[model samples]
Target chain A: MRAVIMHGPGDVRVEDVDKPTLVEATDAIIRVTSTCVCGSDLWPYRGAQKSRGPARMGHEYVGVVEQVGDAVREVAVGDLVVGSFVASDNTCEICQAGFQSRCKHQVMMGSVGTQAEFARIPLADGTLVKVPGEPTPAQMRSLLAASDVLGTGWFAAVAAEAGPGKTVAVVGDGAVGLLAILAAQRLGADRIIAMSRHADRQALARRFGATDIVEERGAEGVARVKELTDGYGAHSTVEAVGTQESMMQAIRSTRPGGHVGFVGVSHGVELDGRDLFNATVSLLGGPAPVRRFLPELIDLIMADEIDPGAVFDLELPLEEAAEGYRAMDERRATKVLLSV
Target chain B: MRAVIMHGPGDVRVEDVDKPTLVEATDAIIRVTSTCVCGSDLWPYRGAQKSRGPARMGHEYVGVVEQVGDAVREVAVGDLVVGSFVASDNTCEICQAGFQSRCKHQVMMGSVGTQAEFARIPLADGTLVKVPGEPTPAQMRSLLAASDVLGTGWFAAVAAEAGPGKTVAVVGDGAVGLLAILAAQRLGADRIIAMSRHADRQALARRFGATDIVEERGAEGVARVKELTDGYGAHSTVEAVGTQESMMQAIRSTRPGGHVGFVGVSHGVELDGRDLFNATVSLLGGPAPVRRFLPELIDLIMADEIDPGAVFDLELPLEEAAEGYRAMDERRATKVLLSV
Candidate 1:
C-alpha cells in the first residue's frame, strides 16, 4: 500500500508501506475511495507542529469496508462508509452524552493514515456510518466531507445555538467556516454573516446563504458586526480560526449573553480571563465530535439538500498526493481531494 | 446622610454626606435599611484596583423607597425593595435576553453609594423588586442577600445548568459560593460538592446543602472531584472565584460537555486559549444580571424556602462600617451586614 508521509517541514512524499490489517477485534479494513488534506495537517506541513518521525498523514476519508473483525456488527464487507478523524466506541459514557471525540476507547484515524490505499478503522461499529448505496460522483464528494469538515461545521453551529431568529457570524473562510454558514442557514438562522476578504470565497459564501459579509478583522471587524446588529453584535458567532485575533473577534462579535462556538484547533493562543468575564458571552468549542453528526450530514448529502463538497476546488489522483498538500498549504485551494 | 468613603487604598472612613435625591425622571431615592461589604470591595481596599479619590463604596443594599421621580412607575414610595449592584432598565433587548448587567441603561449602584443612608437608584421602574411587605429581621437579611450574593449564586447555578440527577461542584467558599450550594440544591441537584479548606466555611457549606467538601485547590481539587464523580468529573461546576487557578479548577473539574458558570470578579487572571479549547467545557460567566432573578429570588425568600443570609456571620451598626470592612478583609467573617 502507498501512503503520503511527511519527512520534514514543507516535505511530503508518497511512499510504499506495509498494508494495514485488523489488529483489534473491533477493527475494520477500509479501502480508501477518497481522502483530503486538512487545515490541521498544515500545522506540521508549515512547521507550526513538529513532525514525529515521518508522521502518517490524513484523517478524513470515504471508504469501502473490505474486511471486519469478529466484534464488528453494524458494518460488513463491501459497505460504503464515512468515518470521523477519530474512531470511538459509541457505547462509552462520553459517546452516549454526544461527545464521541472524548470517548474512553478512541483511536486517532490519523495514525492509520487514511490517505493510503488501505486503513484500519478501530471501533468500526461505532466509527463508520454506512451510506445507503454506491454514491454518485457528487455524492461521493459530499460523503467525503461528512468524514470531518461538514460534520465539524454542523457541530460548531449547534454548539453556538444558531437557530431560528439568530444572527450568526462565522470568523473564517475555510471549508469548515463556509460549511458553517450552510449549517446555520439550515438551522433557520435569520441572518448569516461570513467574514471573508477573498472575492471567490465571499461569492460562494453569498451563494450558500450568507446575508452579509464583513471584510475587516479583529476589533474593527467586531465593530462592523455590532453596527450591522444595531450595536448588539451577532446572536451567535462561530470561531473557525484558532488564532488569538480570530478568537477575540468571535467573542467580541457576539452580544452579551450570546454564544461563541469555536471549532478551530488552537495553536498556543492565550485568552484574557478578565475580557472573557467582562464580555458576558458563553464559550463552547473544542475538537468537534464529528461522529455525532455523520448520520445527519450523510442524509442531507444523499438528499442533495447541501453541496458541501464545493469546497474542494482542486482534486488529484492518489499518486499525486504531494500536489494536493502543496495546493492547500499555499492557499491555492480551500480543500484538495485525492481520488484513490 | 452618612456614607463609607475610601480616601485611598486601605483607608475607609464613615463621613457625613448630602442625602441623595431623584436625579432623573426615572430615578428613585431610597433610605437604605441595610447594606454590606462585598468580596469585590477588597480589590480596591487591597490596592488591586485603583481608587478615584474619596470614592463612595458599597453596591449591595436592601432599602425602603423614600421618594420616586415622575416616571418611576413600578416602585412606589414606602415600598421595601431589593435591587441588584447595577440598576438596569429591564425593558432593553439585552435585559429582555436575561443579561440586565449589560443593559443599555445600566448604572452601577456602587457609583451611587448604596452604603449611604440615602441612595439614588436609576431606572427605578426596572431595577427595584418590591418585597411582599415589611417582614422580620431574618427575612430582611434574606432579602438583602438577594440584592447581590444570593442572586449571583443563583445565576451561577443556573448558568452551570445544575438540575435533577446532576452533581455540582462549587469552586469558592465565600458568601456567594456558599449561596451557590443552596442555589444548586434548590435547582434539584442530586449532589453538591463545595471546595473549601476553612472549617467555618466548610461547616456552613454543608449546612447550606453541600453534600461533600474537598479541601484542595487547583489540579488536585479537580482530581478529587473526578474521584468523587466516578472518574468523569462533576456534571456542573460553579466558579465563584475569578482567579486563574479557580477558573481552571472549575473547568477541569467538569466532564467533557459539562458547564462552568463563573461569577467572581476577575482580578488579573489570564486564561490560556489552548487549555480552554482543549478542555471542551462550556464556560459561562459575568457580572451576573441579578435583576433578572430578583423577582423569583424574592419569592423564594418570602416563602421561607431558603435562607441565604446565614452567610453573614457578623453584624454591626451603620456607624461601624469601617469595622465591618476590616472583619471581612481580615477573613474573620464570611460576610458582614451593616444595619442602618
Candidate 2:
C-alpha cells in the first residue's frame, strides 16, 4: 500500500507501507477511495509546527469497508462509508452532547493515515456512517468532504449561532472557511462576510453564499466588519484561522452578546483575559465534533443539496502525494484531492 | 452630601462632597440607603490594580429616588428602586439582547459613586428597577444585593447553562460565587460543587445549596471535582475570581461541551489559546448585565424567596466607610454594607 508520510519540514512523500489490519474487536479495514490534503497539514510541512517523527498523514476519507472485526456491527465488507477524523464511541456523555471529538475513548484517525490503499478504523460501529448507496463520482468527492471539512464547517456555523437575522463574519479563506460560508448560508444567516485577500478563494466564498468580502486582516479586518454591521460588529463570527491575530479579530468582530466559533487548530495564540472579558462574547470551538453532523452532511451531499467538493481545486493520484502537500503549502491549491 | 473616596491604595475616606444633580435628560438622582464593599474593591485597595486618580468608591446600591430630569419617566421622586452598577438605555440592540451592561451608551455607576448620600443615575429608565413596595431592613439589604452581586451571580449561572440534571461547579467563594450556588440551585442543577478553603465561606456555600465542597485549589481542586463527577468534570462552572488560576480552574473543572460563566473583574489573567481549545468548553463571561435580571430578582427578594444579603456579614455607618474597606481588605468580612 502507498501512504503519505512526512519525513521533515517541507518534505512529504508517498512510499510503500504495510496495509492496515484490524487491531481491535471493533475495528474495520477501509480501502480508501478518496482523501485530501488539509490546511492543518501545511502547519507542520511549513515548520510552523514541530514534527515528532516521520508521521502518517491524512485523517479524512471516504472508503469501502474491506474487512470488519467481529464486534463491528454497523459497517461491513463492501459497504461504502464515511468517518470523522477522530474515532469516537458516539455513546459517551460528551459524544451524546455533540462533542464527539472529545469522546472518552477517542482516537485520532490521522495516526492510521487515511491517505493510503487501506486504513483501519477503530470503534467502527460508532465512528463510521454507512453511505446509503453507491455514490456518483461528484457525490463521492462530496462524501469525502463530509468526513471532515464540511462537517467541521457545519459545526463552526452551529457553534457561532449563525442563523436567521445574523450577520456572520468568517476569518479564514481556506477550504474550511469557504465551506463555513455555505453552512452559514444554509443555516439562514442574513449576511455572510468573507475576510479574504485572495481573488480565487474570495470568488469561491461568494459562490458558497458570502454576501460581502473584506480584503483586510487583523484590526483593520475587524474594523471593516464593524463598519458593515452599523458599528455593532457581526452577530456571529467563525474563526477558521487559529493564529493570535485571527482569534482576536473573531472575538472583536462580534457584538457584545454575539458568538465566536473558532474551528482552527490553535498554534501559538495566547488571549489576554481582560480582552476576552471586556469583549463579552460567547466562544465555543476546538476540534469540531464532525461525527455529530456526518449523517446529515452525507445526506445533503448525496441529495445534491450541497457541493462542498468544489473546494478541491487540484486532484492527483496517491503516488503524487508530495505534490499535493507542496501545492497546498505553497497556496497553489485550496484543497488537493487524492485518488486512493 | 457625603461620599466614599479612595485617596490612594489602602486609603479610603468619607468626606463632604457636592450632592449630584441631574445632568442628562434621562438622569435621576437617588438618595442612597445602602451600599456595600465588593471583592473587586479590594483590587484597587490592595494595589493589584493601578490607581486612576482619587476615585469615587462604590457602584452597588438600593435607594429612594430623589429627583428626575424631564425625560426620566420610569421612576418618580420618593420611589424606592434598585439600579445596576452600569447605566444603560436598555433600548439598544445589545441591551435588548439581555446584555445591558455592554450597551452602546453604558455608563459605569462606579464613577458616579453610589456610596454617597445622593448620586446621579444616567439612563434612569433603563438602569433603575423600582421595588414593588416598601421593604423591611432585611428586604432592603437583599434588594441592594440584587443591584449587583446577586444579579451578577444569576447571570453567571445562566451563562454556564445551569439547569435541571446539570452538575455545577463554582470557583471562588466570594459573594458572587456563593450567590451563584444559590442561583444554580434555583435553576435546578442536579448537584453543586463549591470550591473554597475558608470554613466560614464553605458553611455559607452549603447553606446556599452546595451539594459538595472541594477545599483544594488549582489542579488539585480540578482533580477533586473530576473525582466527584466520576472523572468527567462538571457540566457547568461559574468563575467568580478573575485570576489566572481561577479562570483555568473553572475551565478545567467543566467537561467538554460544558459551559464556564465568569463574572469577576479581570485583573492580570492571560489564557493560553491551546489550553482553551483543547479544553473544548464553552466560555462566556464579562461584567454582568445585571439590569437584565433586576426585575425578577426584585420580585424574589420582595417575596422573601431568597436571602442573598446574608453575604454582608459586616455592617458600618457612613462615617465608618474606611473601616468597611479595611474589614474586607483584611479578610475579616466577606462583604460589608454601608448605611449611607
Candidate 3:
C-alpha cells in the first residue's frame, strides 16, 4: 500500500507503507476509493502549524468496507460508505447532541492516514454511513465530499441559521466557503454574498447561487457587505478561513442578533471579547461534527439534489499525491481529489 | 433636581441639576423612585475604564411616569414603570427580533442619567413597561432589581438555554449571577451550580436555587464544574464577569454543544479563537435586552413568585450617593440601592 506522509514543512511525499488492518473489535478495514486534501492540512505544509516528525495525513475518505471486526453491526463488508474526520461511538451524550467531533471516546481519522490504498476506521458502526448501492461516478464524487467538506459547509449554514429570509455572507473563497453558499441556497436563504476577488472562483460562486460579490478585503470588504444588505450587514455569515482578518470580517459582516458559523481552523486568530459582547451576534462553530450530516448529505447526493463535487476542480491518481498537494498549496486548484 | 456626578475616578457627588423635560414627542419624563449602583459602574470609578469630566452616573431605575408628551400612548403619567438601561423603539426589526438593546433607534438610559431626580426617557412606549397599580416598598425594591440585574440575569438564563433536564452553572456572584440561578430554576433546570468564593454571595446563590457551590477560580473552577457534571461540564453556563479569566472559565465549564450566555460588560478580555473553535460551544450575549423580559418579570414579581431584590444588601438616601459607591467599591455590600 502507498500513503501520503509529511516529513516536514513542504515535504509531502507518496511512499510505500504497510496496509492497515483491524486492531479493535469495533474497527473495520476500508479500501480507499477516494480522498482529498483539506485546508487544515495546508497548515503544516505551509509551516504555519508545526509537524512533529513524519506525520500521517488525510482524514476524509469514501471507501468500501474491505473487512469488519466482530463488533461492527451497522456497516458491513463490501458496503460503500462515507466517514468523517472523527470516528466515534455516536451513542455518547456529546454525539447525541450532534457534536460527535467531541465524543468522549473519539478517534481522529487523521491519525490513521486515509490517503492510501487501505485504512482502518475505528467505531465503524457509528462513524461510517453506508450508501445503499453502488453510486454513479457523479454521485461518488459528491459522496467523497460528504466525507468532510460538504458536511462541514452544511453545518456552517445550519449553525448560522441561513434559512428563508436570511441574507448570508461568506468569508473565504475556499472549497468549503463555496460549498457553504450552495448549502445556504439549499436551505432557502434569500440572498448570498460571496467575498472573492478571483474571476474563476467568483464564477463558480455565482453558479452556486451567490446573489452578490464583494471583492474588497478587510474593512473595505466589511463595508461592501454591509452596503449590499441595507447597511445592517448580513443576517448570517460563514467564515471558512481561520486567519484573524477573516474571523474579524465574518464577525463584522453579521448584523445584531444575526449568527456567525466559523469553521476555520483558527491559527493565530484572537477575538476581541468586547467586540462580540457589543455586536449582539450569536457565534457557533468547531471542527464540525461531519458524521451528523453524512446521512442527509448521502441521500442528497444519491438523489442528485446538490452537486458539491464541483468544488473538486482537479483530480489525480493516488500515486501522484505530491502533485495534488502542490496544486492546492499554490492555489492552482480549489480542491484536489485523489483516486486510489 | 439632584443627580450623581463623577468629577473624577472615586469622586462622586450629588449636585443640584436642572430638571429634565420632554424634548421629543416620543419622550416622557419620569420622577425616579429608586436607583442603584452597578458592577459596571465601578469600571470607570476605579479608573479601569476611562471617564470624561463630570460624567452622569447610573442607568438602573424604577420610577413613576410624572409627565408624558402627546405622542406617548402605551404608558400614562400616573403609571409606575420599570425601564431597561437602554431605551429602544420596539417597531425596529432588531427590536422585533428581541434585541431591543441594539434597536436601530436606541438611547442609552445612562446618557439620560436615571440616577437623577427626574429623567426624560426617549422612546418611552418601547422602553418602559408599566407596573399594574401601585407597588409596595418590597415590590418597589424587586421592580428596581428587574430594571437591570434581574432582567439581565433572566436574559443570561434564556440565552444559555437553561431548561428542564439541563445543568446550569453561573460564573459570577454579583447581583446578576445570583438572580440567574433564580431564572434558571424558573426555567426548570435540573441542577444549578453557583461559582463564588465569597460566603455571603454563595449563601444567597444557594437560597436562589443553586444545587452546588464551587469556590475555586480559573482552571480549578473549570475542573470542579466538569467533575460535578460527570466530566462533561454544565449544559448551560452564564458568564457575568467580563475578565479574561472568567470568560475562559465559563467557556471551559460548558460541555460541547452547550450554550453560554455572557452578560458582563467586557473590559479587556480577549478570546483565543482556536480554543473557542475547538470547544464546540454556542455563545450568545451582549448587554441584556431587558425590555424583552420586563413584562414577564413584572408579572412574576407582582405575583410574589421570586425575590431578586434580596441581592440589594444596602440602602441609602440619594444624598449619600458617595457612600453608596464607596460601600460597593469596598465590597462592604453586595448591592447598594439609592432612594431618590
Model 3: interface root-mean-square deviation in Å: 0.7
Residue A243 displacement (Å), model 2? 0.4
lDDT score for residue A266 of model 3: 92
- What's the DockQ for every one of the candidates? 0.84, 0.91, 0.89
Candidate 3: fraction of native contacts reproduced = 0.91
- Per-prediction share of native contacts kept: 0.84, 0.88, 0.91
Candidate 2 backbone collisions, by pair: none
Per-residue lDDT for B220 in model 1? 92
Mark the regions of model 2 whose C-alpha exceeds 4 Å error after superposition: none
Which clashing pairs does model 3 show? none
lDDT of each residue in B1-340, candidate 1, tens digit only: 8999988888889999988877799999999999999999988888888888899999999999999999989889999999999999999889999999999888988898888798899999999999996577998999999999999999999999999999999999999999999999999999999999999999999988999999999889999999999888998999998887898899999998889999998877788877887788899999999999999999988888889989999999888988888898899999999999
TM-score list, all predictions: 0.99, 0.99, 0.98
- In model 3, chain B matches the true chain B with a TM-score of 0.99
Q: Write the per-residue lDDT of candidate 2 for residues A246-297, one digit (tens) a residue.
A: 9999999999999999999998999999999999999999999999999989
lDDT of 1 by residue, A1-340 (tens): 8998988889999999999999999999999999999988998899998788687889999999999999999999999999999899988778888889877787888888998898999999999999996578999998998898988888899999999999999999999999899999999999999999999899888888899999999889999999999999999999998988899999999999999999989877788888999899999998889999999889899999999999889999988988988998889999999999
Q: Give candidate 2's error at residue A194 in angstroms.
A: 0.8
Q: Residue-wise lDDT of candidate 3 within B115-199, one digit each (tens)?
A: 8898999999999999996677888899999999999999999999999999999999999999999999999999999999999
| B-chain TM-score for every candidate | 0.99, 0.99, 0.99
- Candidate 3 chain A — worst ten consecutive residues by lDDT sum? A132-141
